[model samples]
Target: MTRNRLWYCGITLAVIAVGLASRRFPAMLPAAAGKYPGDVLWTMMVFFGLAVIWPRLGVMRLTVAALAISYAVEFSQLYQAPWINALRTHPLGHLVLGSTFNWPDLAAYTIGAVLAMLLELALRRFAA
Candidate 1:
């Protein structure tokens, strides 16, 4: 594959590693590093995933799309229907669909999206 492809692949893999670390090994992290890092990284991964699939998408458009999807997912936590809640009980589903709806997650998603936009801009400029 091309160097640009490799760069994107590497970034995606690094984000996955960070996301997993933020979630799975909380004890190993700093005292206040509970769900915050994971939440931020998770949204960042979403942005990176979009870039991987659609490299030419502009930063503004990508950021808006990422935020909209992340916000929708967060809002989805408000629905505690029996079946959906039951699905959330499973490990994988729990990871994907968080149990509680926190307003702070919106801020975290925004931070992640902004950071991803800046990072993407820098990468594109340097690559050029």
Candidate 2:
């Protein structure tokens, strides 16, 4: 594989490790940190997942798309429709759909997306 592709792969693995730790080992973190790290990194992982599929895509465009999908999922929590709630009943669903609407999540997602974009740009400029 190419150097850039390898870098993306390494970064994706790191994000997954941190995401799992954020959820699985919450006690290791500061109380104030709460779940924000996982929330932000999870959203950033989503962006990286997309980047893995389309690495040639512009960072700005990927950021916009990722932000749109992340916001849509967060806003959908407001509905709590039976189907959506049922979806949340499963572990994977719970992780993805979430249970309730929180305005702070939007901020978290924005931070995640911007950081993902910046990281991608940096990787392209410095690592490439």
Candidate 3:
């Protein structure tokens, strides 16, 4: 495979591995949370944009979709909608958004997606 494809898989796999490993090990994420919201948001955009530009990767689209899915799940918690809310209480939900919904989370997702799209356009120009 090409270098960009390999980098894409490596970064994606490392992200997953670290995420899972940190769950079992339980100490890595809080430090990340320490980052300024602006920095975190920018990093999200950069990584997501790179995902689109990298050979055989589509990080930007996936990043936006993932944020949307996360937002939907978080919003669903407002309903106490039986299965949905119950599912929200589990570890996966905590990993995604925490136990409650906030209007700010929607704003974050929108901002993240918009930033990702803009970054993708910029990257495409450079790539071309």
The sequence of per-residue lDDT tens digits that candidate 3 reaches over residues 52-128 is 35554554555656566656755775776677667668877655545666666666656655655565566567767
What digit string (tens of lDDT, one per residue) describes model 1 on residues 24-110? 788887977568888888778888777777777778888898888889989999999999999999987887788899999999989
Off by more than 4 A, model 1: 1-6
lDDT for model 2, please. Answer: 0.83
Please report, in order, the local distance difference test score of every candidate based on alpha carbons.
0.83, 0.83, 0.54
Q: Which prediction has more favorable lDDT, 1 or 3? A: 1
Q: Tell me model 3's lDDT, rounded to 2 decimals.
A: 0.54
Q: Which pairs clash in model 3? A: 51-59
- How high a TM-score does candidate 1 get? 0.88
| TM-scores of the models, in the order given | 0.88, 0.88, 0.48
Rate residue 10 of model 2 by lDDT. Answer: 77
Q: Lowest lDDT 10-mer window, candidate 2? A: 1-10
- In each prediction, how many residue pairs overlap at the backbone (N, C-alpha, C within less than 3 A)? 0, 0, 1
- Candidate 1 positional error at 105, Å: 0.8
Positional deviation of residue 128's Cα in model 3 after best superposition, in angstroms: 1.4
Ranking according to lDDT, highest score first: 2, 1, 3
Report the C-alpha lDDT of model 2 over 1-128, residue by residue, as the tens digit: 12356667778889979988889999999989888887788778888877777777777778998899889989989997798899999988988888898999899989999999888777768755
**Candidate 2 stretches greater than 4 Å from native:** 1-10
